[model samples]
Target: MLKVQEIRELIKLIDQSSIDEFTYESDGTTVSMKKSNTAPQVVREAVINTPVQTTDTKLVKPEPVIEARKEVDMEKENQKTEQENTSISSYDHEIVSPMVGTFYSSPTPESDPFVSIGSNVQKDTIVCIVEAMKLFNEIEAEVSGEIVEILVDNGELVEYGQPLFRVKTK
Candidate 1:
């Protein structure tokens, strides 16, 4: 495994090199580096006979810089989410799982479903519940529409990005 100083030196080298990223792996040791506007961030991991150990650290670290980096990371995440929403908008409209979990059509076993085919719905309408990791999350219809189809069944396992209902836009 590379020492901390060695990794730091590599970051400096990469920052000076023409490459934008660098990676190395051998004998259960792995190192990855990527250049950003601020500085290069390096992630190191060891997966030897023992359990895996991982660490991600900045060579030129500062408290305010870390906070700024987090904000930038969050902005990237928000942009990615916006792109995904754009893709979903291409559909007539879809009520989808926000996470991987079991789909529940109703609040209780004997209760009627929140929405059915032909049911008119609007943004903020609770279309269903997704039980993820012991948490029952109310899934909402973010767009106004009429439910054209139910894509998933109650108590069925649903994956992230899976469409639970198809809607005809209002």
Candidate 2:
């Protein structure tokens, strides 16, 4: 039987890839998963075949608990962004993420961050790292500027083209 964590990992991998369906069967147990582009949902069905009886279980990805937590987190983030936008100037340049990945402020957790608010940066300065598919990509400042805001928290999951930092250009 596959663990819940393992199933969740498989769901994430499939969602990121081009595949839309997957199945696994072994030892009288079968696991099947399907993804629909039109809907943001994943359906998983597990079946246990026994000599005398059969058992079936249906599990959906983004369970209610997870969905509710995500909603709350998004609400808080939206509020924070609204306050931040009030202080952001029209001339500020946004440094955006190049790919979908986990954001890291520092090369290593124990070390200081590559850049912080008020830090002066050159166009080529390393500002942070984005880890995607086991690859650690160094993100550059891309503009000569002073860091005005860090849009994402450390270790947060960021989407492609998401703004990572707000810079006041020189």
Candidate 3:
């Protein structure tokens, strides 16, 4: 049976490599780990080897492991559907997230939002906050414009360069 550290090392190895799934077994003991879009999915089975404890064939997963770091966007079909869902297209510009993080429209949940639809903003205007790894980062508009649409919901997860807002230039 692999020790805890050995299992962690195997998970790390799987995550770093392009392999989507990994499995290992020895002396009637088996373990497997897999990575998905949201989190690591581990399916564990009890192994009865030597003097080890008896177990059952079951799936056991640890706490949400760090997800594979990458940017995810709408698929071609989703883009088409969203475009059709849009009522109007005043999308002259976009305020995109600079990094992958959790987006917060307001400083705090109780506070008023930084900006809203039709809110006029300057190039340096703060539009939202993106928190990454416990670090809160203020996202700037970087373009003078009127906010035509809010692309992402408050507290929604965002990817690097993901569109957060659609703006119409002043």
Cα-based TM-score, every candidate: 0.47, 0.52, 0.51
lDDT of predicted model 2: 0.77
- What lDDT tens digits, residue by residue, belong to model 1 across residues 36-142? 78535667665435333347543432221111111134357679999767756644877778999999999999999999988889899999999999999999999
Off by over 4 Å in 1: 1-91
Candidate 3 root-mean-square deviation in Å: 10.9
By summed lDDT, which 10 consecutive residues of candidate 3 come out lowest? 65-74
User: Cα RMSDs of all predictions?
Assistant: 13.7, 12.5, 10.9
Model 2 backbone overlap count: 0
For lDDT, candidate 1 versus 2, the one ahead is 1
Error of 2 at 158 (Å): 0.4
- Candidate 3 is scored at a TM of 0.51
- Residue 161, candidate 1: how far off, in angstroms? 0.2
Off by over 4 Å in 3: 1-89
Clashing residue pairs, backbone N/CA/C < 3 A, model 1: none
Instruction: Give every collision pair in model 3.
Output: none
Winning candidate number (lDDT): 3
Candidate number with greatest TM-score: 2
